[model samples]
Target: MSVLGSLTPLPAADHPELLAEPVVKALSRLPDASGVLVAEIDPDLADTAAFCEAYSSPPEFSANCVVVSGKRSGEVRYAACLVLATTRADVNGVVKRRLDVRKASFAPMDEAVELTGMEYGGITPLGLPEGWPLLIAPEVAAAEAVVVGSGIRGSKLAVPGAVLTALPGAEVVEDLARPA
Candidate 1:
């Protein structure tokens, strides 16, 4: 009788009080947030295609959020949220340029966890720390809906595509992502 019956368990939604502090704080800011979904899965898993297939979700529905560091300061900041299995965030171009950083690179696992308060494979744009830019690819926005991480390694959250764009501090950009 779960909201996502026979699919997966979303820890955040199931135990909202147990969520990481940053996630809790972020969710507090987004009162309209539809809520996050968690699924049970292996932590070592990295392939989005296989993950989607196992979850019975369309590959295109996955939103991949990539964290990048600042160019000059090399500070761990900014994140690009794009659709998985179809498009890759233009990290060096649109993402870097949009952040106004002279250089940018993928954020390390530890750093991603520290800043977002979520596990390496479970970070979602919905409950990210405040001020971290959440850039959405135009194509992702165009989609009718999307599936995002549920703040825990074992789940995913299905939400309206427009809802992703509506999150506080989210920026909808064109060509932010390209086919992988």
Candidate 2:
């Protein structure tokens, strides 16, 4: 295995090898996933900045999945936003308007973790709630590959941009995020 940033790269793995059941199921259900290469990392370094610095990875190669929620009318709506680590999801602007809600904010950590059945720092769009749209920034979907959570803090998945766009419910949006 080789090293990527601060993580120990592993040979290409079946989703079941590195991801939780939910993630595995999601990937398997995709019409034709190109497969993901996984790397093991310290759970403590799962956050994007730390993980990138420790692994010698550039921020552009890492994508963050954030869950957002708000109410439109009387019902709550949820969405997952995927943006590069070098940028921030425009929660109050683009996202709120996209979801057609009065306001939007990051979902409470507990609710995110509980609903996704993934660790707090490892929520990926791959296994998000079925009804939630997977809102991906256009830049993120244009990258060659991006490092994302494997549904657990202990590992990461490197997936092709094409494969990411292929995920169920994924929607590529322009300027969904702003450079930080």
Candidate 3:
């Protein structure tokens, strides 16, 4: 119940204006969507650090979502990763091997935004493309509740952490990330 700071959150489905189009659509299709909550914030404070500092939310209140990409043969593959803000995803080691690519790196900002139909700083795993992988660190999937981006800078979403593991193509990987 207490995921983010003292700021109260509303049912995400009840406040479509706070979410991006894709985020809204994704939530609408989930039967467990009732647990998702949304909180409005100053757009300028949308980034993790600023939002936590300003809202009194703990620094680790949420898992951070990042997009990574790698190419294999003539095809390129992309995946979304969720790790604690205090940790960094193992893009070069575990992830590269998982994707079956020779190398892997963070996806370019513009490409990420365009592909996800979401704002750059607010890219989230909830509404990724159908075939993309969703690699989640065990730490993130085991949390009581996870607060993450809403696909827009003006708001954030919170849901039971286990919920993420059930999303399509979500894979829980140990050491998906290492402490920063």
Candidate 4:
């Protein structure tokens, strides 16, 4: 893969090149995740737009992971959703219904980063908390390959769409994302 800069292709399961505990732990549990590739990045350019622009990776080849939360039975439930960079997660509609909550919104940045042990812009589905559903847009799950966060802003991961769909608790949803 032609990455923007020097990217060390590290194994996704071990992810020794990655420093986030939750990310490493989560990846290790995926039996078919061995093909995922992890690469280092300039933390300042970790956001999807900047990373894609600087690295020349088309937006269609990148996927973004977002955390959302809402109250279900008076208890807060959080879920991670994945969508292509060309689209946005349907938080209020698809996400809310899937979460079984009256309303759903993106989790507060601080809460999401702290709870997931990931940087704000680098939160990924590979290492989310247990019981949290990982909703992926069908378009993203059908792509041959995608670039995603590595839990920390300093790095990113590249893996096949099938690998993401195979992760524990991952659910492929139609219209999960809306055009950006």
Candidate 5:
């Protein structure tokens, strides 16, 4: 794994305080979570661009998890998409068809935060609700190391992409993301 600038990444399992409750719980369930690492960061720089700049990690090396929702037959369905920071999830085209919904849009901030039990900018696919689909862009799923949320703004997690692919409901899709 390459150095993530000046940030110090330590074994995530040894420091539960750096992760949110949901993430910690999720990590416990993963048999291959040994490669996961965590590093402290300024909450104010949690957003992608600022984070990449501050931490000296390229956007392509970071995965941003976004929550999306759509309705079908009067029922609402939610899914999480983990795409590289350098790209954008193709919600209207590929994702809409994948979810079998008429259209898909980003979930409301409050709804996402409440349902995931994680901060708005810190939501991750690892601990999503039981049935939520986790759509991973191919690039993110194939990476050796990727920076992702630790389910909180004050810290970030460095995880092997294989661990993400091992998560429940994770699906790697072609054209899952388009250029940002």
Candidate 6:
């Protein structure tokens, strides 16, 4: 069974009060979401293998979304939601090309927090501000299921890969990530 099937189904619009503010806001907008429990985790847990082992799930069940940013004409634009595990976001090549910027780089921490309303360690693609570029690796889309942040540190949300694509502003692309 998919991990999402095994999780407790909380009201999609009602996330725990302990959740980070941005995650809570995002969950409020997604009326059909659910959450799964994980052992308390640190903020910088970026690797899926580590997260899965800590959460006691298969690596493929864990999805990691990175927010990449670049500057143009002294203004910075950010892109969020790179891929699941095993793939790294191609910020300088594919993503730069997609954004039509001459020089692109990952958004700095302060800007990332300000723009997404997520803490440095807990950003999810679900409730990103309108128009933030959301790139999904094709491999992730091919998965039977994937797990993403619940906008909180201690929980995750598992859903069909297709459901992720259906989210507002999500764009599925080929070779969207660099191999880990």
Question: How many clashes would you count in candidate 2?
Answer: 4
Collision count of model 5:
0
Give TM per candidate: 0.80, 0.92, 0.97, 0.92, 0.97, 0.79
Candidate 4 lDDT: 0.85
Query: Candidate 1: what lDDT?
Result: 0.67
Task: Estimate every model's Cα lDDT from 0 to 1.
Answer: 0.67, 0.84, 0.89, 0.85, 0.89, 0.67
Per-candidate clashes come to: 7, 4, 0, 0, 0, 3
Model 2: colliding residue pairs: 5-55, 5-56, 6-54, 6-55
What candidate 5 gets wrong by more than 4 Å, as runs, is 1-3
> lDDT for model 3, on a 0 to 1 scale?
0.89
lDDT of 3 by residue, 13-117 (tens): 999999999999999888879889999988899888888888888767678999999999879899999998878999999999999999999999999999999
**Off by more than 4 A, model 4:** 1-8, 13-15
What lDDT tens digits, residue by residue, belong to model 1 across residues 22-141? 556666666565445445555454356666655556676677877777655655456746655577888888878887888778888898888787877767777777687788887777
Q: lDDT tens string, model 5, 63-167?
A: 999999999999998999999988999999988998899989999999999999999888987789998889999898899889999899998888888999999
Q: Kindly report which residue stretches of model 2 are placed more than 4 angstroms away from their true locations once superposed.
A: 1-3, 6-8, 11-17
Q: Which pairs of residues have clashing backbones in candidate 4?
A: none
Q: Comparing candidate 2 with candidate 4, which one achieves the higher lDDT?
A: 4
Candidate 6 lDDT, 71-170, residue by residue in tens = 7787777778557676678878999887777887777778777887766656777778888878898877776667776566565656567767767788
Model 3 is weakest, by summed lDDT over 10 consecutive residues, at: 54-63
Q: After aligning candidate 1 to the native by TM-score, how far in Å is the CA of 40 from where it should be?
A: 4.6
